[model samples]
Target: MLQIQELVFDAWGRRFFDGASVSIPKDAKVGLVGRNGVGKSTLFKLILGQLTIGGGEIRLPKQARIGSVDQEHPATPVTLLDTVLEADVERARLLSDLETAPPERMGEIYDRLIEIDADRAPSRAAEILSGLGFSNADLARPMAEFSGGWRMRVALAAALFAEPDLLLLDEPTNYLDLEGALWLEARLRKYPHSAVIISHDREILNNSCDHILHLHDGKLDLYVGGYDSFETQRAEKLRLQEATRAKIEAQRAHMQAFVDRFRYKESKARQAQSRLKMIAKLPVISAVLREHTAPFLLPSPERPLAPPLLRLEGVSVGYGGPPILKNLNLRLDLDDRIGLLGVNGAGKSTFAKLVAGALEAESGEMVRSARLRAGWFHQHQIEALDPTDTPLDIIRRIMPEASEAQRRSRLAQFGLGVAKAETTVADLSGGERARLLLNLVAMEAPHLLILDEPTNHLDIDSRRALLDALNDYEGAVILITHDRSLMELVADRLWLAADGTIKPFEGDMEDYARYVVDRARAAARAPSQVAREEPPPPPRAEPPRKAKTPTGPARRRAEAAEAALARATEALAAIDQALLDPDVFAKDPAKAADLGRRREAAQARLAAAEAEWLEAAEAYEAVKEA
Candidate 1:
């Protein structure tokens, strides 16, 4: 168990943790969450001993190992798989000692190696890397060959593979794609040791963690269950606190009224003194003051555009060289909310650029309305902001004709008040910059809005605010984000960028999640397999003649039953895949137990679907015979 008692930490010009205390039980998966700039990362630093506390104690078991991914692993000659394996210091030490130790002592080292299951370390490392979006062929490559982001993933994979007693992860999904994030959610759920994860992804917090450690008002409060449960519990707690405080205030007021009325009278002086004493003894309860999140301002377009605001026909686009995306045929309406999904290098950004008009198609026809206006907000815009420029300055350039007061008011509506309006971009928080750009792009009420990873810096509440704005906006949206919750809630249609082309995904987010997991599992098994390509859109055929298809309720019932059976079979297969892993139980018993429960549920669903399908089939056959 990790115990933090009366932790007091003072930082530059302010206190971060003031008498904050929380005890995390062993093997607990805790989600550490708070608003942006709330010192969540600072707490991790303190726990890691990078920062000293002002007062109080943080205790851990003796000789307990703590692991964190602070930065990208160094670029070296070591292979990716070997680098991860080296993270296990005990195993590495044992191997080194085996080289020099006497023959008799070698037996002990070998036994220890067997105990740790060191022989399976390579496969374990490869599996972790594959889950994080690494190709199997990349495992044997030198670390120096990979980029910084890939190296960061390697660092995270190393930490996870080590399985330290206390695992501290700070926004692990920031560097991952949606598929990688989903895989991580499953991986963290079954992690063997205790983990304190700092993440803003709601799905992971709700599905992967068993507890939430909320840091607010310089205090730590542990809540059972996930983020949703935390929100409900915290709300009720504040409500009760407010009620108790109101009651206390009323009693104090009543007693004070008596004292004020009778303090100087000769007959009631003693009674007044007693009343004053009673007032003093009343328990103090402070009123709960909830923090308000600034609202995101996304104005709707004044006039709606006709259907098919943008269209592409056999379009291909890229930089100056070979085309990155080819043979694209897609249509977007003024009201369409397109959620673009793909792995890191699956040409998602290329598609976004093509749609946003940043890059013209090299071949084929692209059509758009003559009056079409597109508001494009990409991550690079934030990175490209001038550090010395203030929000007021930015708005001034965009709204050159508007008065300074008008500019500031617009900023205020975008969540930047008077205080932050003049602050330089360098001094402003990431969330502030994100909000400024997001609102700025949509200020003109364009016909279509293309946002790429818009919620990377915003907190959960702010993300919700954005979601609300998007839902309210009358214009089209093409959202590219790693946040699954945002994607599922905001996008009405899903598009997959794969095999150098863009195409519609026929399934929802759940089906896509299963495909991603299955793909990763395949990669883990076959290290040399290439990226999967979309099957050639079944060769076009002449329109088929209308056949005597079955009709009536029985046919409809049969169709529904068949769909249910497909879903049930897929669910069961996913569970069976996990159970088939030989190392799952040995690595994470908790996950194994959870999988057992899920397997039973999947089995039950499968059986019900099968029975329903059989009955529906019989009914449909009878109707057809009639």
Candidate 2:
């Protein structure tokens, strides 16, 4: 068992923890809950011996191995697979001994290798990497090829592969996509090791954790069951406390009234003196104090929005290379609550950039209504703040004409009141900085709000606030996030950006999750192998969109591609009928083989025709718009 007894800690002269004690039994999965900057990470550091404890003791088994996910991973030429495999120090040492050990000592090395499962270590590491959304090709690739977020994934994969006795993960789902997050949750649920995870995602916390550790006001309260159960218990406790407080107040009021009415009376003076003595003997209820749980609701737009706030016509957006989002045609209406779906590098961010006007299309045209006012909130924006500046300083720079009071009031809506507003960004927690970034965007009074992974830094309460605000907002929202609960709550429509095209998705996150997993597993497979696994493309979430009517080449090409698709479909059906005769394979294997080849060729042809049809269909639509 791991135990923290009378743990006392402080930072910058502020006591974050005082006499806090909690015990995590062996194999217990604990969801560490607290507001941002409440010392969850600090406690982890204390356990890791990275921070000096002010008082008390943290006890762990002497043999316990602790593994923690590193926040930052350096860009190195190290192969992704090796990076994960290297996490097992014992395995590395055993393998090294094999190279230098004498012939007689080779037996000892071999025995140690068996103990450590050295032979399967690399393959085990690979399996963990694949579970975290890395493809087979990605395993051999150097870490330097990946972005910072992806490098963090590599770090997580390494920690998971380490398989320590005690695991500490801080917001493990923040860098993952929907499929990856779900996969990680499933893995962690079956993990034999004890874990303490700090996460804003309620689903993950509830699914992966068996216990809840409520850390607040420098105290730790351990609760049984999942996060929902903890909430239920905490709510009931507060309700009862409130009722007791009300009763105490009523009793005190009655007693005071009696004293005030009868204290000076001759005969009743004895009763008044007795009441004062009774009041002195009563226990204090401590005022039922609670940390603020009220949400910081965001303000609505300042001006009415015109319909079709943004439109994309044949937009091809990418870096200085081939387009990631090709010939994209989309429209953002006043009521659009589009949840954009895609993998990490699948142009979701590029699409957001196209809508936010942060990146111009490499080709084609994007038209925005003159009345369009867009609020763009991306994770990078939070990191872009000047750390030396206070919230007041930042807002003053954004709105110099507004008075100090006005600035503070505006910031207060997003939970930065007078005291918090004056706090320097350098002293603020990551979640606070994230909120300040949103507050800055809210001040723009945007007609369209485009948020990309907005809940990554927020606590559960703040995420709830954001979902409520988005639900009640008058303007449209273009949301790109892996928060399934938020997406399910906020999104009225879903836009799927897959296979270099964008279209309305008619299903929910559940359906999208299955699709993502299917896609990821098949990503490294050749088309023929994928065809064998899945004979046809998955069913569309919605009915097939109508083909646009166009003049000239686009129209002609679309028609020709559709005809080709029909022919390919017909030929495949014929091949299927021919192959259906079991007698054919029994009578002549040569004929069966010939039919199989024909079927394969037909499938290849049909796939090509389908691709051409989709391309031509997009072109036809683009031309019609032109």
Best by TM-score: 1
Model 1 Cα lDDT, one tens digit per residue, 63-181: 99999999999999999988999999999999999999999999999999999999888777877888888876788899999999999999999999999999999999988988889
Candidate-wise lDDT, in order: 0.87, 0.79
Pairs that collide, model 2: none
Error of 2 at 428 (Å): 3.1
Residues 405-469 of candidate 2: C-alpha lDDT, one tens digit per residue:
88888788767777888898888878888887876786666888899999888889888877766
Clashing pairs in 1: none
- Clash count for each candidate, listed in order shown: 0, 0
Q: Any idea what lDDT model 2 has?
A: 0.79
Q: List runs of model 2 lying over 4 Å from the truth.
A: 101-117, 144-147, 244-283, 293-307, 311-313, 364-367, 515-626
With candidate 2 superimposed using the best TM-score fit, by how many Å does residue 224's alpha carbon deviate from the native? 1.9
Runs in model 1 with CA error above 4 Å? 529-626
